[model samples]
Target: MSASTSAPANSAPVAHNALPPPSTSSAARSSRIAPHSHIKGLGLSPEGFANLDTAGFIGQNNAREACGVVVDLVKSRKFSGRALLLAGAPGTGKTALALAISHELGAKVPFCPMVGSEVYSTEVKKTEVLAEVFRRAIGLRIKETKEVYEGEVTELTPSESENPLSGYGKTVSHVIVGLKTVKGTKQLRLDPSIYEAILKEKIVVGDVIYVEANTGAVKRVGRSDAYASSYDLESETYVPLPKGDVHKRKELVQDVTLGDLDAANARPQGGQDIMSVMGSLVKSGRTEVTDKLRREVNKVVKSYVDQGVAEVVPGVVFIDEVHMLDIECFTYLNALLESPMAPTVIFATNRGNALVRGTTDVISPHGIPVDLLDRCLIVKTDSYTREQVSKVVQLRANVEGLKFGDGVLDKLAGEGEKSSLRYALQLLTPASILASLAGRTQIDIDDISEMNELFLDAKTSASMISESGAAFGS
Candidate 1:
């Protein structure tokens, strides 16, 4: 038996276009770059107090000021031989200070960061690793002005003829390319190889491009902005037209590392053919750079610097957990610091008095030798106060797209004071999840209490384990 229910006779149907269409907008992205991604600068004001924006720093005023002084010294080219050492307890903002310094130094300056444990390698020697890092921290900015043709490509045509070697095929003899600039226009008859390069670059009419005067190299900048407005939506990159004549002199700038130069010189090309490329792909390992070759490269770099064709840029090398390096590496660093080409070095450690890694009878400050320590300007980061910890918790919550209810941040800071700052920071995500599960946008004290019941801090866990020695089947 089937029974059917009748629909309501007075119900009105909604029209397909009853409401205005939803507005189109770019999606707002939540930035979860890192725990400390919100840090933009040193957060220091002109009088050296905290700035109004805070700049991601809540405390550590002394350390930030010291780093500001270091930045000034670095910019003036007066910082050499002596390295900056940041010594503090774990969870203090040591690495954050280094990052702030790099940001202040400008984007063009190279900043090489590494961990001391990364120096250990089965296939590479330790000294070679150190030397490689030293070379990588140096940069060369080469600037040259050359005559070239650059503009939007108004027309592109290739003239082909019958191949002499193969009658069934045709080869491009020469390409007729027309370029239009703001000031003028020019027509060029380029070689067939340049045409091939143009094809390889996916260049076509309405794209802005440039050709090298001497090398005849074709480089496509982007699609001209004049053609960009024709499409309601596009995926191609667009650039404004150049502001000069089609045939004119242009300045070209290239920034490269000394390590890059060393690698280029270390590996000699097999050939330009496909077989040579396949052979290269089949045999792959780390390239070995020699001392003699490095010296030659340095001489060439010096010559270029003297000829006003290039300038040497002193960069920064930050080694975190630097106490992991042993006596030999420290000795090498002492000599390396005296070199004329050494980069600015910054060493960070969370250790106090400890045994040096490679030594049996030696125990020194921060696990470093006295001589090396003497060559360092030590900056110490202090532990955060309760207020600072609360501020830091708020900053972190903002970074992770979480909100706090009344008294939640203060409760978290108190927990941090009792246990540790890191442990307190670790609870924010889980607390946020608990809040989400409760169908609330703001994390409350009850969520924090639930997290505390689920997860124990290090001290609490250690105490519990000691109280029940045999429970773990030890």
Candidate 2:
């Protein structure tokens, strides 16, 4: 050891193994915690959302404008909370607009995407699913800093041995890494793979390293103190420091999901620490949560926020194909939309005047009930115009890394106007293949026309099979 090496003055090991003092009274030991969180600063700001533009939501101006209004209302918390319905024909950008709105609002609030049909899980009640969705949207992100041991690698040794867990002739190698620090010295037993990582980073005997507290990710931070004189600390000057002070503090941020909170609150007194690990295993909407439990969770959240250990972030619960929900789910939505605790619900559907599922009643516009529809800020997505369709095709082509000629775009736009935008986009791949087969990389009008006929033939065949109710060959 170097003559300058010594323990830090404040490096006395904390009494982490000590037992806690017992409570003297039953009242003191009561597990009940007082409600603390007053929900504030959760409201939206127009200035915070000023940069959010709907330019990415191409082809549907009405839908985009409607979403913009919803965004404004949701951000401002103006209307005491309401559902927004995006009603349109299939492939009319209803889902896109919903996603865009969520993305815009998500910058400040939590934006969680869920499907309507996900509530049908037989493992848990549908109401629980809805409750979890709402809870997840208003969860928190907690960050804590803790001091950790860190040092430069002084010596490394790799040794291989037969794997004890394996019956077969399998082998495993371990690397013993010796580190020198200002605080002291530590030797860590690590896998040989990690030793290779150290070597790959050119980390030799005198390179400083740190281990992340939460993730345990090891990284080379800087060169060692042994070469302090070789390089300048700052402004071409070498400043040497005493050895026993080389340590690092790791900041660990944990985004506590609703599931984690549930697990935490579910534990009995003195078992809260175990819940931290169990929280990651708990899936949202897996079990029914009672109103009492919800209240408890809210209290816990408030307490965490109040103590400055965590901050609550509002989230978006976007349920696409919302018309798939049964009447019972709709009933739940009716009550949820009126509640202040509810997250911003974005529902999108393609149904127009369909029978409400699990009921004899037929509904207008969508399968949704009238009361729920009234609560929703309804937005209708119209079929795309030819110009908009062209732009979308170009955008899609660029996204998919496809090359297309001007004539091809014009042809696709014309076809989209005659049929639907989805059908036009579907034809691009087949047309591209045809173009490639014809010794050309760029999709042209001829390729599109050929693919169009093929699409028509496939559609006709599908209709025939549906009508005949027989196998395709038969």
Candidate 3:
């Protein structure tokens, strides 16, 4: 044997066995295992955490204080159970405060306004829609456990004594065995476990799931309502149960993530479409369906409550030209504020009588119900002072990366008594554009002069030109 082992001179040596190298495709797949690895720990990025000072505004102190109160409530979980309202005139920063709360909570959801005739129209069945909208808005999800039971059979026995009486000592016996069958309904609790599960799975409203019992066939339940209504799932559906079997089993059979606003808005024109639908209804000249419209609006709001989102972060429904709301709409508004989940509402109107009933009602006509008004935090936004207007122009110019010559801000601010923050910003836009066209890196006295000529030449060209010259020292 040893001699034979050395004698294969022409034969090739045995090749050493080894594993093949990994393929490039397999390597690429393994590399992709951490797609989001770069994004980890990016919460509250630096840009998102930037702080802006609101102190330039006159009432900022009051506004900030109010914001602090809301923040405190949220931190204490009080806001999780109740709603808050801020009522004020336009440009008074009511919306700003709402945004601040959302920011403080680190909430990505937006503050959606409850307005438009479609929101109140009967044609839309507003409550259900509103509920759906709220659920969509908050991105709420719900999951439930269901139980099932199986059927069992028992056989009856005949007594030997009865048989003996009839048939001379015949004996008989009956046997009974219990068999478990699948058939029964189970009540599920809306607890933290379900919420955590939903959050973990990223489940949202409008999803469908199968309801299962411990020992029976599974039933399907659709998430037609908001997450808050998950507690009432059993009452809203039907399931079969065996005649004598009562045992039940529960499990999460399936889940489907909902197609909510976030998903919709991810596409082009989603917000535009929503606004168009609501806006057209509001602009409709006829008041024929006002009652039906109001009911629908309330219905939609109720759905928001059912999903727990409304109660957690209620909106501020601002009604511009509020006096135009019909009596029925006003009445509904009053009722809505009383709802546990309805948004805090604010109405703006030039006509005081629209909300008042009698001659003695001398306060501004938009008199909300006393109880509702008591709950409202109201602030009156007054016209800007000359000095305030000047500051606004200067600040706006700076914001545009424009460098104004001495006194040019004063000149722009003195344009007219009606000059406003909006107007100042508008003027800056054009002036900056002209400066760019003129090969200037920054807005200067010349840009303001040109803007003045364009906007106020007819009123006081001489005064404006003189001011411009003085500002430029030309």
- The number of the candidate with the highest lDDT is 1
lDDT of 1: 0.86
**Global CA lDDT computed for model 3:** 0.44
lDDT tens digits, residue span 1-474, model 3: 011122246653322122323555843542222211121111222333313334233334444565556555555645432335444444444444554555555443334544434455654454443443333333222334555433322211222324635656654333221322244333233333333443454333333333233332322233333333536435453223243334434444222112242233332332557787677566634222233443554465458557643433444344444444444444455555455545333444434334443324434335544544455554443455567667656655554456765676776767633444455556776665554444445566666666655675333657778899999995
Report the lDDT tens digits of candidate 2 across residue range 204-234: 6666776554454567777655666644344
lDDT per model vs. reference: 0.86, 0.68, 0.44
- By TM-score, the candidates rank as 1, 2, 3
For candidate 1, write residues 1-474 as lDDT tens digits.
000011134533322223422445666444455866887889887765556448888888888889988888888888888899999988898888888888888788788889998888887777788889989989999999988899999889999999999969899999999999888889999999999999999999999999998999888899998877777667899999988899889989999999989989998688899999988887757766899999999999999999999998888889999999989898998988998989889999999999999999999999999999999999999998888888888888887778988989999999988888999999998777665544466787877887888899999999998879877676
Better of 2 and 3 by lDDT: 2
The TM-score measured for candidate 1 stands at 0.88
For candidate 2, the TM-score is: 0.63
Model 3 TM-score on a 0 to 1 scale: 0.43
lDDT, model 1, position 62 = 85
